[model samples]
Target chain A: MLKVTNDQVAGHKAGDGKLGPLIDDLGRFYKPLQSNERGSNELTFYTSFSTNTRIPGPIRRFFPNFYGTQLVEASDGSSLQPHLVLQDFNFGRVNPSIIDIKIGSRTWDPQASEEYIQKGLKKDRETSSLPLGFRLSGFQIYQNRELGFWKPERTFQSLSADEVDLLLRKFVSSNTSANLDLQPDCSFASIVYGGSTGILSQLLELKAWFEDQTIYHFYACSVLMTYEKEFVSNGKIPCAEIKLIDFAHVYEGQGVIDHNFLGGLCSLIKFISEILITPEECTTEASPKDIQKNQIYFEELIK
Target chain B: MLKVTNDQVAGHKAGDGKLGPLIDDLGRFYKPLQSNERGSNELTFYTSFSTNTRIPGPIRRFFPNFYGTQLVEASDGSSLQPHLVLQDFNFGRVNPSIIDIKIGSRTWDPQASEEYIQKGLKKDRETSSLPLGFRLSGFQIYQNRELGFWKPERTFQSLSADEVDLLLRKFVSSNTSANLDLQPDCSFASIVYGGSTGILSQLLELKAWFEDQTIYHFYACSVLMTYEKEFVSNGKIPCAEIKLIDFAHVYEGQGVIDHNFLGGLCSLIKFISEILITPEECTTEASPKDIQKNQIYFEELIK
Candidate 1:
C-alpha cells in the first residue's frame, strides 16, 4: 500500500544532458532485443509496463536492500511487462547526516564530483546511448527505517590505522576465491523499511524457514519486463511525464528463487564489500566480497 | 505430533480400582462430550440439565481460576462453553536454569490430593451426583517426532520459597473486585501447552496478539513447542495421555499460532482468590474484629 514515487518525497531533479552508449566496449556482454513502435504513445508505454514488470535479476540484485519482494500476480499473462507496483524502498529517504568518511571507502557517485561525473559519462557511453533515468514520486523520512538506502563511495567513516591497512590487504586480490555459501541468520520473507518504521513490501519465498512445521512446497517464477516512454512532464515541470504504455514481455523469466536470490544477495554482497569493506578485500568496487573469513558465525547463532 | 495416553504414563491406573472414577472424573473435566452409545444396553440421562447447565453468575467474581463455566449455545443454548486450555510449558526450552513451580504453590490441586477426592464425592452427592464439568484439555507432555510421547509431571519439583511467594504476589487482587492479571513481563502463554501443541482450543478470545507484527509481543510459543520431549517424560513419569474426544463445536479456530495464548487470562483472578488464596484472606475466614491479627505479616523479600 506504500506508494513509491519521486513526487511523494523531498528534492527532485531531471536530466537535461544527453547520455551516449557506454557498454559496448565491455565486450562479450549481452545485447538488447529489438522492439517495435507501440500501438500507443511512448509515455503510456513506459508507465504501464514499468510498474507491472517483475524486477529483473540484475536490477533486483542491485537493490539488495529491498524489504519485501511482493510477487504480485500480474493481471496480464501475454503482456511482457513488469508488474506495476508501489515500493516501500526509497533512496532519497536517507539521514542527510553529512558526516564524512575517509577516502577510498565506497563507490564514487557520478554526481558526487566532476571527475567522477566524466568517468561515469564515459562508462555510460560504453553501455548505452539513451540516458538511464530514475525519479522519486514521494518519500517520508523516519527512524530505524532509514538504514541500507545510502550508497557510500570512496569514503571511510572512521578507520583505525590497522583497520585501514587490514582492509587494503583484504582487497589486495589475495582472497579472491572463498566460500560465499554462508547463509545469513535472516528470514527469506522480511519487511524492509526506510530509515524509520516506513512499511515496505513483504517478502515471501517458496521454501523459506518460517513455522515450526515444514509444509507445502511449490514452484514459482520471477519475471521482468520493460517499456518505452515519451518526455515526462508534471503539468508545469521542466519535462513532460515519461508515461510508460506497454508491458510486452519479461526482461528475463522462468528461473528458480535460488538463482534469483543468489543474484540479489550477491549484489548486496558487492554493495557491502565496496561501501562497507576496504578496497583491498574486494573484487568489485561496487560491492563487498561474496565470501567471508568465518562461516561459523551465523551457523552457530541460528542453531 | 506428540501424543499422551494414560496407559504408558507412570502414576495413573487404567480402568481399575477405586481411583477409576477419579481418573474418569479427571478425564471428564479435561474434555467432556456426550456419546451416542447406540450399541450399549444402558442409557445415561442428565440429572440437573435444566438447573446446572449454566454456570452461576457468582463464579465470574473469581475469574481465571474458577475453572471455566459453560452456557449451552443451542436453542437450549444454555450450554455455552468457554475456552481455557492448559499444557506443560517447557521452561527448560528457554534455559536449563529456569525454575519450575509446583502445582500447589499458590493453590493446591484439588484433584491431586486425597482430601479433594473425598470432598468432591460428597459435593457430587449433594449436587445431583455430578460435579460441574469443564472444557479443559492437556497439551504439553505429548511425544512428537524427535522426542516421542513424554511426560513432564514426573519431577514433582518444589518451587523455592522465593519463587512461590513471588508467583503468589503476582496474582494481585484488583481494586474494585477480587480479580487477577499477570505481571507485565510475565507472558503466561508458555504455560498453555497440552499433550500436543494443538490443545489450545481455549484461548479464542485472545487471538489478536498472535496473528501479526514482530515484537514477539506476548510469549514465545514456538520455542515452547520445540523443546526436547525427553525431559518431559522423564519428569511427568506418571502422566496421562489425555485428550478431548470432541471440542463440541468449541474454539474460535485461532489456528496453531494462536492456540498457546492463554484464553482465560481474565479468569485467573478467581483461580487465585478462590483456590489459591488462604481462607484467612477472605472475609469468610477472618472475623470482623481481629482480622488484622489473623492475617500473616507480608514479607517483602527473603535471602
Candidate 2:
C-alpha cells in the first residue's frame, strides 16, 4: 500500500482533508493525476518527452525517470485514479532537505485564459519571480533529529531577491540547527551545489540544452533540489540532485526559443553561483529598503 | 596517455606490433574505429541507438553508454585515428572475471561479401555457435592473488554443446583457485546470474526487447559478462553485468524479426538457466564421444 508522502515541501499537496502524492517502499512516488486538461497535458508532456529522440541522453537525465502510470486507490478514499509513477528523489535518505523553486517570470502561457493569466501574473509580481525570474515555491530544512523540520512561512514565498539569496544560503548552511541566529556557514554549499556532479553542474548542463532547444516552453515548472542533511553533520560526502518537475503548464515551442524558461534558469543559476562564490554576502543582513533597491537594480540589470 | 587494457579477453586486440583498444584513468574504453563502412555503420548505429526514443529507457540500459567519439593518437604510431569512447565494464574492479560470447549461428549478414560470409561460416561451424547458436569468443578468470589469471586455450572456442556447458560451470566455480582438479561447486552462480538484478534477469530483459524490436538486426555482436571475482571470495555481494558489444555487423531489420540473434540469446539463456537449476549436472563430466552425441542432439533440437 502506498502512503502519503510527508516530505513534499511544495506544489499542490494534501491539505484540508484532501488527497495528495503517495510513496511506495520501492522508492517510487505516485502523483495522482489531475482530471482536467492540466492532467492530460502533463501526461502528454511526459509521454512526448520520454520518447523525444531529439533530447540527448544527458539532458534527459535532468527530468525524473517516468515509469508510466498506474491506477491506484486515491488517497482521498475515492475510486482508483491514474497516478504518474516516478523515481522518488528523497528515497533512501535520512533527514533530507528539499526545496522547489518555480522558474520563469511569466508563469502562465499566452494561450491561457485571461483569468488564469491575471492570477498567475499577480502571484509572479508578488514573489521573487518578477525580479529574479524564479521564486521559491517552498522549502523545508531538516535541522536535527530533536529540532526536527524547519520551514519558513508562506510569506517567504514572497521574498525579495536579497531575501531569496539568504534563503538559498540557509538551505546549504550546516550550522542552522546549532544556532538559528548565527549567520549561515554554507559548509554544505560545495557538496550540494559545487563540483562536477553537483547541482550547479547539473543546472549548467540543463542550461546548455535549453540554450538551443526550441522544442518546449516550460511555464510554472520547478527545479526541485534535494540532499541528505545527515550527510552534512556526519561529514559524509552527500549525493545532492536537482530535477525538473511539474510539467502541467508545458507547451510546444514550435521551433522558437523558449526564452522565458531559459531566462529564469539563467537567473536562478546566477543566484546560486553567487551564493557558492560569495557565501559571506549570502547571509549578510540588509535593510528592507536596501533589499527593495537591490531587487529593482537586479531586475533592471537582467532586462 | 591511454594504456592497452590487460583485462580484455577477446576480440581484435593489441598483438604482433598492432594497436588495439585503449583504456584511460577515467574508466573509458577507447576502441579504434575501422576506416571502413563498418566504422561508419557502428558510429551510425550508436548515434541512432543513443537518440532512439523508440527504445524504452529500461531496454536502452542494456547497451554501453556511448560518449560520442574522439580522434586520438593511433596506438600503432600512425596518423590520428577516430575511436569510440564507451564505459569500460572492468572499470574500478578488483580481480574481475570476464567473458565474451559472440551470439547467433549466422555471424555475417546478407549484405556481407562472399569472402566475409565464407570466413564467418567456417569459424561459426568450427565453434559451438552452429550447434548451440552461441559461441564463447574468450574468457579469463582471476584465480587468486597467487594464481593470477586462469584462461583456457583458444581451442576451448570449438567446444561442443556438452563441453560449453562444462565451461559455463567452470565460470561460476569459486573453488577453481583452491583446487583445479575438483568439480565446480557452482557457488557463484546465484550471485552472478540469479536474483532480479543479476545477469540472468538482465539477459531476460534484453530478450524481451529482442522479441519485439525490429529496428536493427545485430550480427556478430557479443554479450560481455563481467563480475568481480574478489566479491565471491570475500562473501561480498557481487555486481554482475551483461552488456551487448561489437556492433560492426549490424544491419537494418526493416520490420523483420531478428531470429538469428534472438535464437542465440535464448540458447545462451537456456544454458545459464540449467546451470542455476541443476548445479550437479553442470559439473558432471561425460565421455568425449557422448559429448559429441549431445552436440548433434542439441543442433537437431534447435532446428
Candidate 3:
C-alpha cells in the first residue's frame, strides 16, 4: 500500500481530497500529475532535463533521479493517473532531519499572469525571501529520537531577519527542541554543512552550474536538505544531501543567467557558512539582551 | 518491469529458467514461493512468527518485515505466482557491500530424510561450516565505487578456519578490493561492528533472545550482513544491518534451545570481535609467514 510520506517537509501534500505524492515500499516516490498546465510543464521539464546532453554529468546529481513516469491508482480513488516516478531521498533513513528552503526573492516566472505575479510577490515580500533572498518554507528536526516539526500554522512568512538566522541556527543545533528555540549548541553545523562532502559543497556545485548555464529558470523551487539525526546525535559524520525540488514554475532561461536563484543560493550559503564559523560557547552563553545586541551588530554589519 | 535483484548475494536466483527473487522499484523484495512443501513451510514460519506473541518485539526486528504476499507475473513467463512481499534491506543503498553467511555446523534438521541428512553432512564437512560453525555462502563488496562480487564458481565451501577469519577481516577492511585480498586495514571494523549500535551489539541483542526463546530451529538459514561502502569509505559511521533470512527449512523447536543457530552466531560474533581488537599495524606489517603462524595461534586458541 502507498503511504503519504511524513518526511515531506514542504510543498503540496496528500490531503483535503487533493492528490499528493505517495511513497511505496520500494523507495519509489509517485507524484500524482496535476490535471493542469503546471503538471504538464513539470513533466516536460523532467523529460527534457533528463536527456539534455548539455547538462554535465556532475550537475545531474543535484536533481532527483527521474525514472520517467507511471500510471498508478490515484490516492483519491480516481482512475489511473500518470505520476512522476522519482527517487525517494528520505528512504532508508532513521529519524531524518529535513528542511525545505524556497529560493529566490521573486518566486513568479516572467511569463506568469499579472495576478499570479502579484500573489507570488506578496509572499516573497512577507517572508525572508525579500530581505535574505530565501525563506524557510518548512522544517522537521528529530531530537532525542522524537520528531519536532515546524508548525504549519506559523507559515514562517513573518519571521524577522534575526528570527531567520535563529531558525537556521536551530536547524544545526543538537540541543534545540521543537519549539524553535535559539540554542547554543552548533556542534552539528560543521559536520553537516562544512565538510568537503557536506551541503555547502553540494550547493556550491549547483551554484557553479547556475552561474554559467542558461538552460532553465526555476521559480518557486526549493532546496531540500536532509541528514540522519540519529547519525548526527551519535557523533557520526553526517552525510547530507541537497536536492532542488519543485518545477511547476520552471521556464526556459532564454540564455540569461538565473540571477534570482543565484542570489538566493549565495545568501543561503552565506548564512550556513556564518553558522559554521560562529563560536558555540558564545551562542550558548548569550542572554536575550546579548542576542538582541548581536542582532543589532549583525544588522549594522550587513548595512 | 520487475528486475532480478543484482544485490542478492546468495540463494536461489532467477536465472536457469527458474523463478527467483525480484525487486520492485518501490524497494519491496518479492521472493517467489516454491511450489513444494519448502515454500509452504517458509510461508507458515513468517505468518506465525509475525503474530507470535511469545516472541519479544526486539527479536522481531532481526527478521525481514513481512508485508504479506503478492501475486505477480512470474519471472519465467508463467502464470501469476504468489511471492512473499518483504522489505528489501538493500534498498536506497549506494554501493552496498553484502555478505550472506549460512549459519550452523549442522545445516540439516532432524526431520530431514536419511539421504538428505547424509548429503548435507557431506557438504558441511567439506566446507568451513564443520570446522568454524559457519560458512560464507556468497558475498559482494563495493570498492572505489565499483562492485566486485565473489565468484559463484568458488562457492566458498572449502575455506579453512583461518581463511574464514581472513574473510571476516576483509569484509571490514576499506582497502580490500573485490579480489578478496587479505588487507591490513580494519579501519571500518570498530564503526561497523564494535560500537554500541554496530553489528556486534545487534548480534548480542539477538543472541540474548535466542538464549531463552524456544520458537523454531532454522536449518540452512542465513544471516545477511550489509552496509554502505560509500559511507564507510567516506569516514562516516557505517550503519550495518544484520537480518535472519531464508526460513525454508525452519522447524518447530519443541521447547528446546536453538543451539545450532546460536552456536554459529556466537562463532561469527567472535570472529568479528577478534577483527575489531586486532591492531591495524600488526596486520599491516605481517608477512605471509607471520599470517601462517598467526593462523596456527588462532587454531590453538579456538581449541
Candidate 4:
C-alpha cells in the first residue's frame, strides 16, 4: 500500500492525488496526435501514463499500479475517515530482485528532520538552493543503486544502522580517486549513507529520466526502487541493487529547460559529498575552466 | 497532395475522406488511454495513424508532412468547383533516396488493370481469401523498405522501363541459389520486375512491420518507396530502389489473421515468379510439411 499524504506528512495534500491535472496536461499535449492511418501508438493510456508497458523489463514489477486515492483520518484527528482505498498497478512482468523504496518531499518526517538534514542553505548558495518556483515539499528521493527483493506494497523503509554503515564503506572503497579511509563508527555512517544515498538516487533518476526519454519531471518525489535480494553476504550491502520509480509529473517538449530540479539535484550531490568525507576530498568539483566553457557555449547559442 | 477519393476513382469515395469512421475507431481504441497523468503524446492529429514515424529511419525521410488534401471535380457532375484542391503533406524530415510506391486494395487503379493486377482469386486459395468478416474495400498496403529523399510533397512515381530492367537484373543476379539468368529484353524485364517487386516489397514490409512494432497490417496495399538517386547507374534501374507505403488499416491484437491481403500478396508473388522464370524454377515453394506443422500448432492452441 502506498503511503497516504495529508497535512501531517507535509503542508500540502499528497501531490500524487494531483493525478487529475497530470491527466489533463497529457491529454492536451497529446491532442494533436489524432490520426486515421499510420503513426505511433505510444501516446495511449496504457503505454504513456501507466507503468504497465513503459517500465522496462528489468524494473517494471516494482511499480505495479497507479492505485487510486484513499482518505484516512490522521492520527492527530485532522479529517473524516471513510474508506482508504489502495490502488494496485500491474505495471509489467515481475522481476524477483525488486525492493521498492519511495522517498522525497512528502516522505520527510517532520519529527526526524533535525538529525537527517540540517536547517538552512549550504555555504555555496547555488548548489544548496532549490530551483526557482520548485517546492521542497514535492522533492522525492529515488534510489535504484542497490539490489533488493521483490515485495509489492513496500513503502519507504529506513535503512538499518548496519546497512547504512556497510553501504558507505562500499562507496568509499569503490572510489579509488577519493583517498578517504572507511570510517570506523557505524552511527556516523548511518547518517551519511542512509540520508545522502536516498537523495542521491532521486537525483540520478531525474538525470536518467531526461536522458532516456527527453522528458523532464517537475515533481521528482514519490520514488519507487527495485533491487535484487540474494547479494547479501556477511552484513556488507552491495552498492548496485537499487532502482527508482514514478514518472507521473514528467513532461515532453522542445527547449524546455529545468532549473529548479537541477538545482535541487546539485544541492543533494553537494550535501552527500559534505556528509561522506572532508570537503576538500569531494570529487564532484566544478572546475573554473569547465564552467567558463559552458558559459561561452551558452552565450554563443543565445547570440 | 493526398489523392482524394471520389466517385470517379472507385465505386466509393476516397478512403482518406472517410476520416469519420477512422476517427471513431481510433478514438474508441485510444479512449482507454485517457489518463489524468502518464500516457503518450504521440497520438496528436497525425502521429497515431500515419507511418511517418513508425517507418524505419532508413525510409522515413521520403514521406514527410501531412500534405494537405485536394478537391477534384467529380466526374458525376456532383459538385460545382472551379478548382480541385490537392493535399500536400510536409512530413518531418527528408532522406535522399526514396522512391515511394503505395499499393494495396485502395491503390487499385480503375482503368489500368491489364498492366497492373487483374481481379481474381489466386490458384492458391489461402492467399486470396478474406479473414472471416474483413472487407476487401478496406485493404491497404504498407512499404518502407527502401531509403528515400526528404523532399516534401513528393508523391508516388512509377519506375521507368530502364530502371525496372536494371533492378530485375540485379535481383536475379544477386540470388546465387536461383539458377536463372537475367533476360535481355527491357519490356519483359519491366513486366517481371515491376509486378513482382511491387508485391514482394509489400510482403517484406508486412513481415518486417510485425517483427519491428508487433502491429499487423491487414489491408497492406498502399505502398511507398524511397531510393537513392546515385544508385541509378546509367539508366539501368537498381532493384534496391523500391519501397511500399500505407499502414492506415493495421491493427494491434492477437491472431487477427490477414487472409485477403496475404492472399493478394501471394498471388502477386506467384505472378512475379511465373514472369521471372519457368513455374518449376520458382524458389518460393512451401513444403506441405511446414504447412502441416503450422496447422497442428494452431489446432492445439485453439483446443
TM-score: which candidate is best?
A: 2
lDDT per residue (tens digit) for residues A1-303 in model 4? 223321111222334432111112111111112132111221332245454444455334222333333344332343433221222221222222222222221221112234332332211112111111112122121122352221112221232212222223333232211122223222222332344344345445554443233123333333322221122222434233233333333343222223223323332333334445542332212365533543443244224
Runs of candidate 1 exceeding 4 Å displacement? A1-89, A93-303, B1-249, B252-303
TM-score for each candidate, following the candidate numbering: 0.17, 0.47, 0.47, 0.23
| lDDT winner between candidates 3 and 4 | 3
Taking the tens digit of each residue's C-alpha lDDT, what string does model 1 give over A1-303?
Answer: 212122212211212221111111212111111234221222233343345344334233212121212232222222233222222222222231111111111112211345653463343223211010111111211112323112223223132222222222222211212222232211100111111211111111211211111111111111111100110111221110011111222122111111212122122222222323233232322233423323332233223
Highest lDDT scorer: 2
Candidate structures ordered by lDDT, highest first: 2, 3, 4, 1
Question: Which residues of candidate 2, in runs, are more than 4 Å off?
Answer: A1-303, B177-182, B287-303
Evaluate candidate 1 by giving its C-alpha RMSD to the native, one decimal.
Answer: 27.2
The ten-residue window of minimal lDDT in model 1 chain B covers B128-137
Which regions of candidate 4 deviate over 4 angstroms? A1-57, A64-69, A81-234, A239-282, A285-303, B1-227, B230-303
Residue range A1-303, candidate 3, lDDT tens digits: 788888877777785566789998889899988779999999999999999999999888888889998998877777789999998888888677888999876687645787786687668656766555678888877677454543343466555545666666766777766442445477788888888999888988987776566678888899998887668777786768898898988888653446567656766775676677773634323487857665554354324
Report residue A194 deviation for candidate 2 (angstroms): 57
Please give the RMSD to the true structure for each candidate, in Å: 27.2, 20.2, 28.8, 23.2
Q: Mark the regions of model 3 whose C-alpha exceeds 4 Å error after superposition.
A: A1-303, B15-17, B146-153, B178-180, B279-303
lDDT of 2 by residue, A1-303 (tens): 788787888866753457788889999999989999999999999999999999999888778889999999878878798999988877888778988999875688766886796698678767766555688888888888888877644545676555677668878987665344336778889889999989899998987676556578898999998888788668877778888999999998653345566656766776788778887765435565665554554344324
Better of 2 and 4 by lDDT: 2
lDDT of each: 0.22, 0.77, 0.74, 0.28
Tens-digit lDDT string for candidate 1 (B188-281): 2222222233113222112223222111112111111122323443552221111111111112211111111221121222222222324223
